[model samples]
Target: MPRPEALVRRAAAAALEETGARGAITVLLADDAAVKRLNGRHRAKAKPTNVLSFPAEAPGYLGDVAVALGVVRREARGAGRRTADHLAHLVAHGALHLAGYDHLAAGEARRMERAEARIMRRLGRPNPWRGAT
Candidate 1:
């Protein structure tokens, strides 16, 4: 597998291609505390999450994707997945969000999951929701 940073860039590019979206996305690898602060400030949630996406307000700009290193590592270990693989999944998820995909509803979530699976597969990564119920 490629390095974590490479995987992130690959995943983001794949997601953009999968969604036929234009522009570029900025990826930020941050610690848990920083992510927690961002989550609290922007999302009104005072906890660290795996990933967060801030879509660009202007046209021709994709958006920003932030990943919490500590949280991601912990979650990947708990799930028995490789760190790079998990990071790729998170990057893809955030990129999809930038492409205007949402999982707020069941139907929307299913669609998003399917899209993510396809994108990950194209990147030579495993299906993130393979065993999901």
Candidate 2:
């Protein structure tokens, strides 16, 4: 909606604050092509996802977050949510990952989801996993 970069930075800052994580984070707001390339190169996933996080090794640097603008827009349209809200969710999700949160297991998923819900609520947005089983 407004400036995607500003939205991402604000959302990320909120997430990092909520998680008590301190560091400088970088976020890339790009089209599907750039996200797809990064996904393929880093994760071996050929398709573009809504967001991806790459942790940094340098001190005082948290990590890099990449979001596919097209993908996020499509998902927001499908979910009946505003693009800006959806962007905040994805950025928070990526920031959580940068903060060492994961959902590879069922228990881990529950933990991560709870954290995400808290972040979304703090942002005055709905929980992104409201309908999930």
Candidate 3:
């Protein structure tokens, strides 16, 4: 497998292509504490999550995606997936969010998951939600 950073970049690119997002997106590999702060400040969640997507305000810019290393590692272990694979999934998920996909509704979730599956498959990764309930 490629290095983690490489996997992340490739996944982001694939997601952008799938969603037809123009311009650029920033990827931040952050620690739990940093992510926790961001989550609290931006989302009011007061906890670190595996990934967070901040969509750009303008049309030409895609936005930013942040992943917490520690949280992601723990989640990947719990999910019985490789760290790189999990990271790739998160990157794709974030990109999808930047492209205006959301799971706030059931139908929207299904659509987003389908897009994720397709993007991951194209990146030669396994379906992240294969056994998800």
TM-score of each: 0.95, 0.94, 0.94
- Local accuracy of candidate 2 as per-residue lDDT tens digits, 1-133: 7677777777898899888999999999999999999999999999999999999999999999999999999999987889998999999999999999999999998998898889888888888889855
Off by over 4 Å in 3: 1-3
Instruction: Output candidate 3 Cα RMSD.
Output: 1.5
lDDT against the true structure, each candidate: 0.92, 0.91, 0.91
The regions of model 2 sitting more than 4 angstroms off are none
Query: In candidate 2, where is summed lDDT lowest over 10 consecutive residues?
Result: 1-10
> After superposition on all CA atoms, what RMSD does each candidate show versus the true structure?
1.4, 1.1, 1.5
Q: How do these models rank on lDDT, best leading?
A: 1, 2, 3
In candidate 1, position 10 carries an lDDT of: 94
Candidates 1 and 3 compared: the better one by lDDT is: 1
> Best candidate, lDDT-wise?
1
lDDT of 3 by residue, 2-30 (tens): 45888888999998899887778999999
Q: Candidate 2 — which pairs collide?
A: none
Candidate 1 regions off by >4 Å?
Answer: 1-3
Clashes of each: 0, 0, 0
Which pairs of residues collide in model 1? none
Q: List the residue pairs that clash in candidate 3.
A: none
lDDT tens digits by residue: candidate 1, 13-102:
999999999998999999999999999999999999999999998878989999999998999899889888889999999999999999
Model 2's TM-score against the true structure:
0.94
